[model samples]
Target chain A: MTKSLKTVQLSHGGGGKEMDQLIKSVFFEAFNNPILCSEEDAAKLHLSGPVAFTTDSFTVAPLFFAGGNIGKLAIAGTVNDLAMMAAQPEYLSCSFIIEEGFAIDDLVTIVNSMAAELHQSGARIVCGDTKVVPKGCADGLFINTTGIGRIIYPDVSANNIVAGDAIIVSRDIGRHGATILMAREGLALESELTSDCATLWPIVEQLIAANIPIHAMRDATRGGLSAVLNEWAKASNIGIDVNESAIPVADEVKGLCELFGFEPFDLANEGTFIIALPQAIAQGAIEVMQRYGHCQQAAIIGHATSAHSGKVVLTTPWGSHRYLDLPQGELLPRIC
Target chain B: MTKSLKTVQLSHGGGGKEMDQLIKSVFFEAFNNPILCSEEDAAKLHLSGPVAFTTDSFTVAPLFFAGGNIGKLAIAGTVNDLAMMAAQPEYLSCSFIIEEGFAIDDLVTIVNSMAAELHQSGARIVCGDTKVVPKGCADGLFINTTGIGRIIYPDVSANNIVAGDAIIVSRDIGRHGATILMAREGLALESELTSDCATLWPIVEQLIAANIPIHAMRDATRGGLSAVLNEWAKASNIGIDVNESAIPVADEVKGLCELFGFEPFDLANEGTFIIALPQAIAQGAIEVMQRYGHCQQAAIIGHATSAHSGKVVLTTPWGSHRYLDLPQGELLPRIC
Candidate 1:
């Protein structure tokens, strides 16, 4: 093969002449198919009735980093989205944004990582796209993911969320964000921290096995407790009141945030969640979360309310109370 | 407030400090959820049976392409995915990867387009995420999408594909790809080429209304017709032989491909399909497709076989036989 031009260029990502050339030279020849040839905007089929869909993007820097890579993030992000709906994710597709001169090895690492994660999630990588930009236009790698999960639950909806619901969180908050920050920032901390990047379907199975009625559930991510609560409040047209001290946070997280001027509540957290259920069933939900070694710190941090409207308030240890607000900005980008 | 950074950086994309800064500064503040907090590889939920799933990604370069933009692509891709599966796409989540210094107008345009598309598709943007990257290390924009659709077909699977099945196409091949190629390549031509980007759920509804015994179906995408056939071959474990003369390709596409060194059989198509039906229902199927407007060029190019053993072969204009292969690599990468 001729080394036409060793470096990636904006055209590669432009979907123009250069992009056509790269794809024809590499991908089309390798993956040739008639359906792929027409290159329409969306695939059409004769499939009918009830479908699940999802999307995600990986902005992981360095492309290849510790624990996992961009490709892995691509798969995990979308698969997790589907799982959040209590659906079994089945299909996945992705788009890639690569800066010029991005290492092909790094791309491969990302792809393989995605493959591994997809396999673990029980999903198939059915469709995808890739683009390359100018060298000075982008970081080495970025990936966007979309996934579809089979609709196993027909009755579950935000409308089903009700008041007097119990709140249950799985695991500690901010592990993934804190760990990544510590690792990248080279925080000389003797305390070991790792990204809480595990999958949660197994834990979900445990909860479902309890045969309990859970009103609503959400993953506590970028906005941490405040964001999740606010969303639930707006969706269910109710307020959520919480005992701040009841929530779980690690000593390491407290130390790191206070030192870095980060707020534990506003800062991002990984592998955490908030579940709304009847106050009576709150204990059962927590018991299910505890079965998973990951949820050892599960707690009932709040209850849904109808009075305060779309706001979440927390009763802090201090004499005064604090109203937790939705994270004001990007607290953490691609923690998942 | 502090001019921390306007453009995205590798650290921001990473699951670390910079990533934290980006999210804290932007997305987290806008939308927060407990599931999102889980920073785990996945957020799982327990569901009440048969489900539907779909996923899509967007990589329309220039961040503000002519026809639409990344945002529209993101939404349309997932919506269409659900539609093809015969599911009513209900909820959606969007993920974005943006480069630094991108024109805010372009972002707004993309978002507006997405909002419009979502409306047209009858889907709600229930959840989403955004990530920013360093200017030099990222593109102007990219998006990933996932959606939820309710499954309506009690009996829909590849298992029904069989020897007597007839393959019906929804429309002419090459419109979407040719138009994209022409537009992206700046190919000045007598024929104005534009993408055949349209929703097919309505047309699909018409097909189902016909009440024919439709067995297997697939959307022609990355690999085009050959890829779909290959998938059908293995999926249903049956062979299919196509008659090239019977397959339809627009004259514009033919002329454009020859001029650009492209192959109509090896391009990316988003809005084409290969549907399998019992031989008895083949003509009726085509008639139904033609009535749908989108299926005007619909043709019965092939039939399922048992003897050939999961292989797809094409009988050419020259009366010679050739095997259709899967695209080995990306074709017109990032076209979506």
Candidate 2:
């Protein structure tokens, strides 16, 4: 039997003993289920009406990073995107571009992380493919995942959001970005931050179960909160006025941002989220999100408006408001 | 406006002028669809019924070459995989990993090529992402695409293949492989044999429309026809007898294989396919395939048998037979 924890080689792509060993040791162990165990090139399944489809690719540098690895990021990224659309993530396909000579132990660790994350989030990886490149041709690993889900709710999209809708954030901002920066900079802080990389499906499911009319939902990702808010404003053809005091920022994150001369709002986030709910139910939504997030900081940070269409204005603590645009360019590289 | 034929730089990932230019010059033009034109982070759509999902990563070395680039191959590769499963190619997600300092023009060319290919195949690239790695961490470019298509048929699986089925090869074997070899080795043939990297969805759609019950199907990719056939035989616990004379091979590929002491059967094929059907419907299926291939060279190269179980035996013209097995390893690295 091939040893399980050695560095991986091109032999793994040969579809022979080494390949089998790798699958059994890593992917199969992490992603195994009745459907995945079949190991077909495509997955076949029975389904009901109104399906939702979403796909994402994860290319986090160092593969194994400070707070989370590429595997968790891959699963969480797609599942969160689906949740934002009010779709229950059902099946997923994982494709890997593995740099030859990557350590098997690292691959196994990453795969195991993915399995744990999937199990926790109630998502399954149903089909997958793996490819290897010459040692110097790629980083240790890059993963791309595609997901399919059933849209229990027929009405879901940014188009559904109305001008009077109220915007609610699930929790504090900038933890994911802060953790990544700290990891990269090797900076020590009074309060070490962990990524808010938890799955939002449960929270989304809860909201749907309560029968709330959601106009729009999005997880603050590459562009951060400001980017997603600006995109929502633009996409919905409405204006949003957010109070900086109401936007939840961890005190430590605020301190770190000030020191680093970065705006926490524009930083990358993996765990934070934003939701647009009917104005009348905004407070109730915040209450529920606080119960789930266990963060007292959940707040009604902004309100959607009819005037000054497609722009987001942030009201500063000094009473002056400034237009908050989507991330203009690269703030941090490889945050995902 | 970004010029169409300019070099792509790392700044394309920055969501600035380069990024807008990249999307406008290539994706907007080739696809020419409503969804792709929006150029949003996600593509919203309507859907119904069961769906088939598949993902593939393309890390072919020498990213740019004579026949196709990584982008086109990336789209065509996933679309073809979906078609092989008898699914209507609907949506695709493209993710890129760029080695820093790679050419921006090459990236644009690749994206345009992919757009043209996807448009031709009747598939749309709705969602995509980009990432960059420091130089030496990757080859110039690597692309991973994941696709979701509706399953138009009720049943499709390699397990559906029975003990006695006819196997067909759409056309000449190893053109894709030989072309890669010629480019890599600089071995000139009598005529240029560019890789046949076209999408097979049209031909597949025609086959499905013919209402033939295909027991099994597969693209003879990395490990080649021999590898796929062996996998089917093992999965179904049956034996296969292939007619060596009936097996189509281009003269250039044959000459190179002989000179390099290689077997055409074991080489990677980017454009060819392998399919299994009941013996009675085999000829009809072949007719259906040829009608769309525009290359009327579909041939019955083999039959599934109960004897010599779990093996692929090739019958030579001289009445001699040779046992063919799955390819042991890569004949060429990153040949798509």
For residues A1-336, write the lDDT of model 2, one tens digit per residue.
Answer: 445447777767644435656666678777778787664567765566765566666766546555688898889888887788788888888988787888877787888888888875688998888887778777788888877766766566665567888888888898877777777776634346777777778888888888887778888877688878877777788899899998888887898799788788888777677888788998777776777743467788888899889889999999998998766545666777
lDDT of 2 at B133: 63
Off by over 4 Å in 2: A2-5, A14-17, A188-191, B1-11, B14-26, B36-41, B188-191, B292-294
Top-TM-score structure, candidate number:
2
- Candidate with the greatest DockQ versus the true structure: 2
- Against the true structure, what is each candidate's TM-score? 0.69, 0.93
Candidate 1 regions with alpha-carbon error over 4 angstroms:
A1-56, A62-172, A188-191, A199-217, A229-251, A274-322, B1-52, B62-94, B100-127, B134-138, B147-168, B188-191, B233-241, B276-281, B302-321, B328-330
Lowest lDDT 10-mer window, candidate 1 chain B? Answer: B39-48
- In the range A1-336, model 1's lDDT, one tens digit per residue, is 212565555556543345556655644443344433323333323233344455556666445444456666566656655666666676665566677686544554455566667666667654556666555556666666666566554444454567777777787787766766676676625566655665565666567667766566666666666666766777678878888788788888888888777777665544566677788978878888887787888888878777687778888877467677766544554454
Instruction: Put down candidate 2 lDDT per residue, B1-336, tens digits, no spaces.
Output: 546444445555543335555656655665567765553335656666766778888887667555677777888788888888788888887777787777766766787788778876778877766666666767888888888777776566766677778899988887777777777776634457767677888888878888988778888877778878888888888899999999989888899899888788877777678888888988898888777543478889989999988888989989899998777654676777
lDDT of each: 0.63, 0.76
Shift of residue A264 alpha carbon in model 1, Å: 1.4
